[model samples]
Target: DRVRIFSRRLTDVTDSIPEMVDYAKTKVKASEFLIEGEVIALGEGGKPVPFQDLMRRFRRVHGVEDMVEKIPLRLYLFDVLQCDGKTLIDLPYTERWEILASLAPTESLAPRIMTRDPKVVNDFMQAALKEGHEGLMAKSLTSDYAPGARGKKWFKIKPSDRLDVVIVAADWGSGRRVGWLSNYHLAVRDDTTGEYLVVGKTFKGLTDAEFDMITKRLQELKIRESKWTVHVKPEIVVEVAHNEIQKSPRYKSGFALRFARIAKFRDDKTPEEADTIQRLRKLYEKQFENKGRLLKEVP
Candidate 1:
């Protein structure tokens, strides 16, 4: 039997995480299956590691065994699209999950509970959070599995926080935002050096009028321009909301925002008043207070 893994972008990632492939071959009971599962890096006491560790495994082309040993992965299967050459996507979630549970071990399946009580759901969310998980997913039992689409049937529960950050640059928008400068590069101030370091970028949560206004403002503040990006002075401040703060090697500050979006413009705040990298570092550290660390530092 042959098996393949894919990234969210649908790229073939079977080679990147050989342990997953190996697990499927040696551990999985089904001979022919197409499963939807998430591979999470595990740390001490079977706790999930940081997002960067999981990403590091995905990006590695060699020394995968060493990386796998350093940051062990656990696959939690949620949906079984196919099993034993039988299609399961059209089946209801309850049926499909039942079929999936039969094919995989309980340890390999995502922890789930069936309940309609609001208080039970809240308590489950709290349990998930206490275990260092971001949140829990709520899915309608009657709904069939749909690829790449999140409808009312499926909901993600999580907490979000906001911080004032400066826009250091922006990319030219396409489609609806045609001539407007969008896809803002978000950064935090370095209080000690008086410089701004990029943490992430996003073009979410903006109105047409706000887009027009910000485009004009960025154009006026533009210090330099490139083929796709316009570099600007980090003077403007905006409050951006994010689900999580992640350790990143791509940015100079070694931090990035996950699911970040502009909440509102902070005209009352200046660049100096914006959140600093030090503050971000503290927040990042605070995130894993209950969770076990996979590694002392990113490998």
Candidate 2:
């Protein structure tokens, strides 16, 4: 039996994760089945690894077995849309969960609880964080699976890691942001070399007013400029929030910040007082105390 795993935009990524396909073929009871689930890379003691590890595993085309042995995967099925050639999308969330439970092994199902108590929800959220998960998804029991529409049927609750980084450069903006250096190049300092290592970039979490103000300050601190990007003196510091730090060859520091955005300006701190590359490295290394070498594909 053949199974297909389509990800965002319905892209066929089946070959990238043959292990999941194999599990679905042998473990899942349905002849024709469609399920919605989360697949995270597993680390030591079966704790979840950083999201970057999962991403690298998803991109493998060759040497997949090596990667698989390094970073095994675990799936948590939460919904089922089809089973045995019958459609189940019309079913409510709770009903679909029941169907999924019957088809998937108990250990393959997501940790489930039915409760309206805020204290219970809060405690569950804390537990998810402790398990190295981003957060929890709260789905309405009566709602149907509405594909491609993120309208209130489920709510995602996540907490981000924040760091104070300096702007080393900025690119010119287009469209409505034209005439403003809206996109920022964010970086952290290497204490040993006194160099600024770029971690990521973003044009988010800032208002037009704030953008205008920062543009003026950055232009004043400008040390050099090119056609599209203006390299600055790294004097302007700001607090930045991101989902995770990934091992990346794109930067000299071999680190990239995922989904980075400006949180707020840090006028109270000087560039010299900003967070350092060593701090980012510590967080990256902590993503796998014993498993990153085995599981993480360096990219």
Candidate number achieving the greatest TM-score relative to the actual structure: 1
- Per-residue lDDT of 39 in model 1: 85
Q: CA shift at 260, candidate 1, in angstroms?
A: 1.5
Off by over 4 Å in 1: 296-298
User: Global CA lDDT of candidate 1, please?
Assistant: 0.89
**Where does candidate 2 clash, by residue pair?**
70-294, 70-295
* C-alpha local distance difference test of each model: 0.89, 0.86
**lDDT by residue (tens digit), candidate 1, 246-272:** 878899999899999999999999899
List all candidate RMSDs to the true structure.
Answer: 2.1, 2.6
Error of 1 at 245 (Å): 2.3
Clashing pairs in 1: none
Off by over 4 Å in 2: 84-87, 287-299
